[model samples]
Target chain A: MTVAAARVPAASTPSFIGGMSRRAKVIWTRRLVLLGLVVAFEIYARFIGNPRLFSPPSAIVYALFDEILVDPRIRGAIYQAFTEVLVAYVMAIIIGLVVGLSVGWSNFGRRSFYPIVILLYAIPQVILLPLFVLTFGIGPACKIAFGVSHGIFPIIVNVVAGMRNVNALYLRSASSMGASNFDLARHVYFPHMVPSLFAGLRLGMTLTLLGVILAELYVSTGGIGYWTKLYAETFDPAPLFALIAVLAVMAILLNELVRIAERRFTRWRN
Target chain B: MNDQANFTTRSIQVAFLAIMAGVWYGLTKTGAVTPLFLPPMDIVYATFMRLVQTGQFWSAVRVTLFTIAQAWIIAVVAGLLVAYLVTRSRHWTAVMEPLIASTFAIPLTLLFPVFILFFGIGPASKVAYAATYGFFPVALITIAGLNSVDERYLRAAKSMGASSFDTFRHVLFPAAFPVILTGLRVSFFISFASVLGGETLSSAAGVGKAISLAAELMEPARMYAWIVFVIITAVSLNFIVSAIENRRREY
Candidate 1:
């Protein structure tokens, strides 16, 4: 902090002022356009685009309460998707943590399984949503399964990575003090792994949402996906837009929760 | 920390692949599971060869890759422009970075139907969605990477009589290049997934469509074959990018 602040002294010399610009002005000038672009887009969307292509913000806004909130089934499906996501996320954490530790903690296990994990992670899991629905049945189970598959890999990878580079010195020193196995794990390994676990959680949250949303859309038999398909097929963008906005709000809140948790848990780390 | 032997790491990786292939073969060959449910390794290999030989696979792949390429190009250009605009200030990166990041967290799969409705079932929809999905990470990373560059380098170049353009060309570009490249790699892979997604949802043709068609047609072996091909392709791209990235850091 001091070093960075020291540079500020030379931040406003005549020569500095000659070419230097105010950071505040630069920040505002760039950010001011965000509102401008939205205003311009609102104008274009509301006035120029095909009504089917986009609703004017006013129409879309009206649809949120009039069409979406008024429909009990749509509301139910939205809630169902939310619950499925929450459950799937918890399941993914448990499975990923166990699997990651099992493989990563042993050289032999790591050699056998990490390859499979990486290979599966690379492939686009969304492509298999239909098959997942077919196999797991076209219900929340399939969506939850798909979501777990997407969510678990990032967690496993991050957890394993966090364990791999535990400076041997810490382990050695702990053991020298006659620390028991559980004590060693608690005092050394757990603290070392905390930051990376939170990092994985952030990624896991994003992927879990993607997985659930993909499965939901693919099922076309039940849940939010069913409603989205209905709206699209019937050429009703109002309800479709409204339902999606609700989902977006859910996603934002979930992501924010994870972010807050990450901050709370990983506060000691750099 | 003990530096593990390179040969040991190499063998571990190789051994991992061997065991995986063994399990895959064992699962299918013993007839414990139905062939359609879990096709034999030889059968899948045969299907792969047939698909590749007949060139039925290329058309779908070409379309999918083309969509990804187009979207990535659009995203890179737009994201770089926006990021450069954002890097003009510190506070802008702070406020707008979160805004962009939060907007990006939305599944975006929700917007797929909207894209399909607007653009019709075509590559255009695929391109738009893929670009929209890829654009966020690119812009976010570019701004972060550029902002994180050391100020002394900029000042040093300025004191040496370099103009802003020269400073950017010589100092800023090189420093930010590695992080920006990583962003491109991330975006490209994401764009690939999203393009596949758009095509699967509604498209004239693409690899995703191939998978969907295969599944509905009940051709499990062929579906497995195509999926295996995509998995290989994705893994290889990741390997190549990581290799290039690792190599770049040395120079």
Candidate 2:
């Protein structure tokens, strides 16, 4: 009878309160902290902060749905930015792969050209923003070119690094077995490149986003830059905050896409 | 064989550069590309010489350097403080490190407009933006550096009757110095780039502003001149930094 009573009491305790693993608890704590920050900001903005410069979370959300999304002009600008990023990313991958392969395929190519590539990469690309504008004009073309310039370097550098590190033993054994150069490349070089190339893709996405946005903001006469400039000048912080939040979300989603692709493609490494 | 290979690579690089110069000169001199698109080399050189002699050039450079210095100071102080605090406990590290890293993954440039809203289009805005941008690398690297110190060193120091402060000072700091130095170098360049970017976007003064202004005025020669100056400075700075790092590694 005593054992039955104890079991009943133990079973009566709430499972929800007792079931969390340590990681889940930590994750919940982080979420709660973030929520707490949002709440704090909401309170400060509503009561204490300057309305012209700071808008509460609720107002920003409302503005997002009502003002920014519903407007056709703003929508087109966002679309243009998205398209620019996509095109630039594709171009960067193609060009970076070509350059990287050509320059990293042989000892002569690596030694002769890699230093020059690094030198070009070291320059502050922002310093050339104006030059880009002058060369391509202040259109989507300028933004796309700038994005490619920024994104291509990381990919090339990483591809070269990856291709250089193939095991000498593997190469010698394969060649001794009468493998052709094409066979060697397919069997050895390609496998080694997957992980490093993915890493570069992730970085390339980030830099491409940065380059496109920098061009967008610098041109201030059209696209997202114009809208941001207008909102800032007019001191309409709600729509302004909403627009920026949208861009941030888009960037995060793109980055996540690259990361997922990296994981999916590089599983052989494990 | 290795020496010959080295000589061949060196000559190839030299030849490649010579050919590029030749092509550029040939294209411009022949007017195959318009002067508006690619100014003559002599014109750009003369423009750069004239720009260097101007007081406006010096002031613009001064402003940019000053902004970079300010941003760097802010980033270092805040980054070290946060890193030290967060490293006080493993739980803190677990909670904060991912938060910092994920936030950094989002191009912080998206927030540049917000910065302008609050700080306006002055050096103040650029300072805040650059400092915020730079803080991430400093904090992340410092946290890693501090956490990576060998536990055996700490134990040895403790067994020798060393106090906690002494243990940290003698055993921990030196071991972590190289990584922390790398973090500082990275942060410096980040600050430099961010400040330049901010000025380029919307600023009243700085080298970036000068470049943009030249572009707006359709003064291609002047703009190219400013660009060449910046490229030289940036390249030289990179070399200087690597030299310093090599020296540190030797010791």
Candidate 3:
């Protein structure tokens, strides 16, 4: 009778409260501790950091909207940089697609050209930032050029890789059906490559931003680089952190946009 | 890595390089490009050999290597610990994974000035910045590795009366090892690039600084040689990493 009564109590416990494992409890507490640390950092930044070299979350929040937005030049520069990114992205996709198709369509082209692209990509193009400025002369042209150079390779590589792996059985089946070349390529090839092409797009965006930012920082006499250096040299942490936060926001938005596109296009994959 | 094939792929690579060299030689030979803008292949090759002969090139390489080593050590240790903690909870991983990845998405290069302010114009700054950047990949991959252990094996081990440590050591480690190796490979390259970048952007001495100095002094051949050296180093590192991963994948 006592054992039956004990078992009865076990059945009464709900799923919501049932079987709280020790390890899970530990993990929750640990994460709580990390979140707590972030709060503590905010507190410390507010209280301890020098206003010249560091700003609290509160100050940064205010600076970004108030001072940062109020300045037309700063806003314009940010706008210009964003536009540069967009144009470069479009150009990269077009070039990447053309090169990818051309290389993958033939055995000879793939053999000789792909390696050259890979080698060029492997080079730390950041080292050439000064030369870019020297050659392009510090306008948006240099920035766009650098961005394209960095961004296009991954797309090309991925597109080629994507197109190369289509099953021969499918191609043969299509040909056996007397499908035209245009039909085979349009229907069979492009769809197969979309997943990898998107993957390359994501990577290309990352590299493009890296390049644009590097160029901006090197030019130092104009654009975002000018402000960053000015703030760094002058010991004004408020505007520095604020400006960085703005750029960070831009990067996040761009990435999120790409990720959504990736998800949308890759739905047919799984 | 996803699409590497056999000798057919390599032949294309070889032919492409030959054609590139031919173009370079032809252009310089025909004066389509000046020696100042694009030096003769022989001159560049000789300069590269000379750089290798000098102790200065080795010293620069050593400095760069040292920075990467220090950064990677910190990143691996910190990342593993954090990942271990994160994997203990589904909720925490859900909350923090996106946050961490997003933070990584922001080019840490933007924060170099801050690192410089804190650490100064030296290896300390480079090491710190590289480690900060390197930490993201390591931690992200570790989380991925730990979270995606094969459930069947885990359950089988549990049924067989294996302890948590045994499950972790035998099942989890091996399962995640390949992915973690990829993360390590990525971190290594990221560290290498960032370290070089730091030196170029602001540093007292390093290969990056050497390249800048060469450029500033208008020595195109030497600068080209330095670039060639960097390309070789990056590619070889990439090759070694993939080779290790490939061999390990077999087992």
- Best prediction by lDDT: 2
Candidate number of the best DockQ: 1
Q: What residue pairs clash in candidate 3, if any at all?
A: A52-A237, A111-B12, A112-B12
Residue A208: error of model 1 in Å?
0.3
Which 10-residue span in candidate 2 chain B carries the lowest summed lDDT? B88-97
Candidate 2: give the clashing pairs. none
Chain B TM-score against the true chain B, candidate 2: 0.94
Give lDDT tens digits, candidate 3, residues A128-166. Answer: 765676567789999998888888888888887887888
lDDT against the true structure, per candidate, is: 0.79, 0.86, 0.77
lDDT of 3 by residue, B39-92 (tens): 889999999999999999999888888988999899888887787777665666
**CA RMSD of all predictions:** 5.9, 9.0, 9.0
Chain A of candidate 3 scores what in TM-score? 0.84
**Residue B216 C-alpha lDDT in model 3:** 72
| DockQ-derived CAPRI band for the predicted complex in model 2 | acceptable
- Candidate number that wins on TM-score, 2 or 3: 2
The digit string of per-residue lDDT tens for model 2 on B160-230 reads: 99987787679877888887777787788889989999999999999999999998998989988998899
User: What does the lDDT read for residue A120 in candidate 3?
Assistant: 71
Docking quality tier of candidate 1?
acceptable
